[model samples]
Target: MIKVSEALAIVAENSSNMPVQRIPVRKALGYILAETLYSPIDMPPFRQSAMDGYAFIHSEKHQYDVISTSQAGDHSNIKLNENEAVRIFTGAFVPKNADTVVMQEHVLANKDSILIAAMPPQFSNIRNKGEQIAKEEVVFEANTLITPAAIGFLACLGITEITVYKKPKVAILVTGNELVKPGKKLPKGKIYESNSVMLEAALQTIGINKTKVYKVKDNLKATKKALKGILEKYDVVLISGGISVGDYDFVKDALLANGVEELFYKINQKPGKPMFFGSKKDTLVFALPGNPASSLTNFYIYVYPAIKNRMGFSDIHLPKLVRKLNDPITNTTGKTLFLKALYDETNVTILDGQASSMLNTFAIANSLLIVPDDVEGLKKGQLVTLLPIN
Candidate 1:
């Protein structure tokens, strides 16, 4: 019965990074960079205009005449001298001997000559070459998650492709002879299978869109056969609803018989104490509790971090927010409890009917209120830790 933090450390230390794969920039969002990206060329590689103005030498005061017009992508072999200025539009390259730009509104322009109405500051409105970024600089570091902003930055550096970590394949399995699929009428004493679909959607939110789902009956032979066959095909296997102390609870025994080394079982947490974890041939397996709230909590507290670590993310925890409790709540004194909560600007209110079997509580919860194991109860207006759900 190790603490949750201790168990997390163990799992993180054991997980390995995924293999690197080359992907186009458009498809690299949410993937982790496997290699450092260096800039091949300078940003704004040449001197250009920062505004629509006249480019001229600052040393030549208000007495200057418009010599030639320069627009973007204009590589005209034009030169400037004293008392001469170029009609420069935005992003046009500054001609030689022009070190300053005067806005059109600040100057009086006639047919041939232009008069500076005000004194233009030195280097004003002139965008220098390589001012934004220098060549050969490290733009994106290795192991960084590729976000939309990161992808845009890479594209700005002319990077069309990048090396990123491959996504892990997760296999979701649901067990119960009385369980039936959704959209079909269930017989008496039967319920629609939901753990598999919920877990599949949850995994997709964490950037793992590829998953294999299997629904097995509550039988040792069928469960064992499914586990043995799928263990080799996926990096992580998630089995729901067969780890409790029932006559048909055979997940733990089957894994042991098949040579899977148990890492830990029966955590001291509420709603998910019967959860189990094990490994065999580099494939990780998690036996989640059957209840909807327990399964969701187990995924957030354990499985999510495991998958994130393998994807090259260094920080695998959700962001925490500080909030005041809106109502008092009581819990057992020896096991940590994660209560489904809804938090806004003023207060965080625990959802009613927090039992493991309640699914509606989870649907409205935007955060989880983390109650310590030794605490018995909380009072209204007391500050508590809130973990936001993505």
Candidate 2:
């Protein structure tokens, strides 16, 4: 068996980065930047008003007269003189020779002349040219995820389109003869299928909205047929269950029979030790354990990062938190264990009765408490590393 980190490295090394494509600014949200975006023009290209106020020479004190009103998008080439003031709204361009802006509330206005009650400090209420951004400077770097704030920033820099990595198409295969579709009454030992829905939801959260799901029986012929059909259509293939050494586990055998080379199998980790990876042609396949918690945990720890990196994201790991364990938890000194935990601002508590097939506990978990394989157990209030799950 290979170490978890080493197995993860193999997956990362084999995955290919997505190609770059030009997309409209409206559709670029959640996509990763393929190239650095430089500002073609300075943000706020000209000096503008930061508030609704009067722009005038500060030294002229009470000798200022109202000349004209300036709203947003005013292009009048009017310049200010000593004792002359312009009524400027927020985001309007500041006129020349206006050194300060006195708020409207502070100015006593008459028909012709305005009496200044309080003089604002120099450069007050003014947004200077290039103050937010400079011309020809990098506004966003490559590999940065395009979020709402990033989109707004790019628009502020006058960018109408951007280059981003193409989103990967994922195909999910859930194999089991005893599994029945939802809404159907289970017969004897059969249970309703849930892995397909869970995996699809997980993929959608990371912006990979394009997905196809295939339900295959545990028979070798049926499983092999479905796997071959999906490999031709999707960029990445995720198969849940049927990878272990049991008689019904035929995923590894089918892949090898179809000319798919096994990259690695069996990581040294609990709840997901039966995970395996293989590749045929350009399609990458991950065989996750059948148990819901184990499958999801392996997907987060191994597969999700590979997909993110292939999509051109620089940061592939989830955010981690240092928290104190609220209960004592014991584990064997072999495989690393990721315990489902509930963590908030005040406390982090590990959930009791953890089984790989259970789903109720995972739904309420906010973080995963990582227990090293070398440690036998942890006492209450012990500091531990927690990885947040979205």
lDDT of 1: 0.87
Instruction: For model 2, state the Cα shift of residue 67 in Å.
Output: 1.3
lDDT tens digits, residue span 300-356, model 1: 888998999889887887778989999997876588888889999879999887899
TM-score of every prediction relative to native: 0.91, 0.96
Indicate the residue-level lDDT of 272 in model 1. Answer: 76
- The regions of model 2 sitting more than 4 angstroms off are 345-347
- Tell me the deviation in Å of residue 317 in model 2: 1.6
TM-score of 1: 0.91
**Model 2 clashing residue pairs (backbone):** none
Looking at candidate 2, the ten consecutive residues that score lowest on lDDT are 56-65
